[model samples]
Target: MIIERKQYKLLEKIIFEKLVIQAPFKIPNPMPDEACFLYMLEGQINYKTENQNVSVPQNESVLLKCGNYFSQIKNDKSATLHQIIIVHFHPKILKSIYSSDLPEIFKKPSFIDDKIDLSHINNDFLIQKYIENLMFYFDNPTLVNDDILILKFKEIILLLCQTKNASTIQQILSQLFSPTSFTFKEIIENNLYSNFSLVEFANLANLSLSSFKREFKKNYSDTPANYIRNKKLEKSTELLALSEERITDIAFDCGFKNLANFSHLFNAKYNCSPSLYRLNLKDK
Candidate 1:
């Protein structure tokens, strides 16, 4: 089934909370501004993405990028899972905390590497306690202090890094910084329909525009504009399949200037016009 992209909530720019999820639930694909860390408190979770599938058991944590597609299948019918403390923050929040020395891992999107498992990390008890405290604060929002909350978050990440392989840290950082270099699967799943200039995107990564463009091309073998346009076309196809919206409206909503330009790009990218694509989808 084709899924429509939902506008992300820009909640507080930096916010932390606890998540308790039941089994057999699917998490819809996230928007670019939302990222999360899942630390399993009890039971087992089978997580699937386009490129990989991972089974996370109790006391294990998985870091998910905003662009990644993930769904969970519960292993036990009676099992209950607690995602300890989830910290959702924008890139700007990290910049304010780390300044220019922001760790490279935070720059790019990555699944925490296999070599770096949180289950074996020391201070698991401490981490659990930290989460408990945060949850308490969440329950009592009136007494929450931003400074203390941010400090606790920094401590949690620092400790996780200390327990992980050094190389994994570097790779994660690189991925966070260069979103344009994201894997082809990620490119398709991320729903990059919003039009953004190279300069604007580079600024998000704290990189000079020219340097960002150079690195982007080197990694993805496509210019940012072309990549974004192609992604929009892909989304337009899904919208055509699932919605009764007129092709021209869908084109403009997806960032095309006009129907002619949208049809031309769609044909170039998919070798079919929008109406024909929808017709084929209906036939299927």
Candidate 2:
């Protein structure tokens, strides 16, 4: 439950927001087109992603790439209530802030290898002070104006550029402006390895669930679940036969969160467990 909420906007777009909520509640980032910088004021949060979930602890922060993410606020006795500060980075706003000359960081590719949609920033004094200043605006809302808010938002961008994860941050921030367009099949193929829910896959494909299903069937001739499952299973077989990776690791790599489920599917598909399959392949 949200006990209180406050926000500041620029040209009707949410620039900064502060939220105080009761713990043990699920929260999803509703904004799909813009990335956000989330600072943990009171408690921690875990950003659910395709590959690995990223945790933002108290006094720390995370920069998420533009996408739908689900999060949870655990009921930790040490911190019962959760307070969060969100700074939104919209592409239109960025272009406006930089005027005709956009920053080079937004143009250059970071060539980041991890490809994780979220980047974690370690403890930084500048960001901590910046959060404190944001709290001031939250406390003194009446004094804020659009110009000041824009300046404050720009200040955050400058500070972010100075952070250790500047390249990765730039990489995420860059995607907002020089956005890449992927086809429905391309999008599905790119993220086929990870374990994403059908709804999340729909969001990635920029379609409603029903529309996504219809389009998927038209393009792939199969339901999303069956296609993704068979694809993941196929990848597991290739890895099991070729790589020295452990069965457990292969399960995770193939998007099965549990070894038992991977084993069951592997047995049903290949007529043997992953371990045995690898052993039999070695003998051949």
Off by over 4 Å in 2: 76-79, 110-114, 180-284
lDDT of 1 by residue, 210-260 (tens): 877787787679887877787788789889988997786577557665679
lDDT of candidate 2 over 1-284, digit per residue (tens): 68888988887788899999876555555455688888999888866676658778899999888754445555435237889998988877888888887766677573744466878987789999999988998999888998889889888888988999888888788778755566788778866766678998898877999999999999999999999999999999899888997787678666775789999988998898889889999999
TM-score of 1: 0.50
What's model 2's lDDT at 16? 95
What TM value does model 2 have?
0.64
Off by over 4 Å in 1: 1-11, 33-35, 76-84, 104-123, 181-284
lDDT of each: 0.58, 0.80
